[model samples]
Target: MKILVADDSRVMRQIVIRTLRQAGFDDHEIVEAPDGAAAKDSVASENPDLVLSDWNMPNMSGIELLHALRASGNTVPFAFVTSECSDEMIAKAEAGGALFLISKPFTAETFRDRLSDILG
Candidate 1:
């Protein structure tokens, strides 16, 4: 599986990738995107199996990326691994066809649990 990890912070992206490996998902191919706009381009060009993106980003937001993908008829699995997790954001994510929204400070176990439901 090819997974795209999108975040403005390089450190956070590394953390997410490390967590994924620690969660026992180390065998899959991983890709990185600095922002949502790059993520959108990667989705089209790379055709990743799944996308894990931060909510707040420069150029384009995660929500915007999801909306754009859906609007353009791209059904690639998308999830948010962001710090912002308001009820409103959650509602919007769900309504926009996101598979899941994982808040920050999450553990490897959390990644495994949430990812199992989607990637399995």
Candidate 2:
């Protein structure tokens, strides 16, 4: 499985990757995107199995990326791993077809619980 981790902060992306590994998802290929726009491009070129993106990004926002992918008839599974997890953002993410919104400060257990079925 190919997982795309998108975040403006390089450290955060690395952290996410580390968490994925710690969650026992270390065997799969990992892709990194600095922002949502890059993530969109990666989706088209790499055809990742899943996308984990930040909510606020430079070129495009995570929600916008989701909308764009869906509008383009791409059904790749998408999720948000962001710090801005307000009620409104959660609603928007769900309505825009995100599989789930994982707030910041999450643990490996959280990733395992949310992604076991999908990643497996």
Candidate 3:
């Protein structure tokens, strides 16, 4: 499986990648993007199996990326690994067709658990 880890912070991006490997995704292909716009380009070019993005970004927001993908007819699985995990935010993401979301301050166990439900 291919995973796209998109976040503005280099540290956070590394954390997500590390957590994914620690969570048993070692065989999976991993890609990284600094912002939503780069992620969009990646979707078209990289053809990633999944996308994990941050909520807040410079070029475009994660939600905006989701909406753009939906509008452009891309049905690839996408999730947000965001710091701002609110009911309202989740509702909006769900309404926009997100696969799942994991809140920030998460653990490798959390990544494993949430990812199992999605990848299993």
Candidate 4:
């Protein structure tokens, strides 16, 4: 499976990739995006199986990217890997068709627990 991970911080993206590997997702292809706008473009160009994006990003926010994908009728599984996990954000993510939200400082177990069924 191809997973696109979008985050403004390069370090965070690397950390996420490492954690994904630790979660036993080492076989999958990982595509990285520096911000949501690039992520949106990558969705169209790369056609990833899933998107794991940071909430707050430059150019476009993760939620906006989600909305844009849905508006374009692209139903590729989308989720968030962000630091902000307020009630409002969760509600908005769900309403916008996100599969799940994985907050930052996450563990390998969290990725496994949240992504087993989806990845399978």
| TM-scores, one per candidate | 0.97, 0.98, 0.96, 0.98
* Off by more than 4 A, model 4: none
Q: Residue 96 deviation, candidate 3, in Å?
A: 0.7
Among all windows of ten consecutive residues in candidate 2, which has the lowest summed lDDT?
A: 82-91
Pick by TM-score: 1 or 4, better one? 4
Cα lDDT tens digits for candidate 4, 69-114: 9999999999999999999999999999998799988999999999
Instruction: Please rank every candidate by lDDT, starting with the best.
Output: 4, 1, 2, 3
Q: Per-residue lDDT for 1-120 in model 2, tens only?
A: 999999999999999999999999999999999988999999999999999999999999999999999999999999999988899999999999999999999999999999999998
Candidate 1 local distance difference test against the native: 0.95
Clashing residue pairs in candidate 2 (N, C-alpha, C atoms within 3 angstroms) = none
Model 2 misplacement above 4 A:
none
Candidate 3 error regions (>4 Å): none
Q: In model 1, which range of ten residues has the least summed lDDT? A: 111-120
Model 1, C-alpha of 65: deviation from truth (Å): 0.4
The lDDT for every candidate, in the order shown, is 0.95, 0.94, 0.92, 0.95
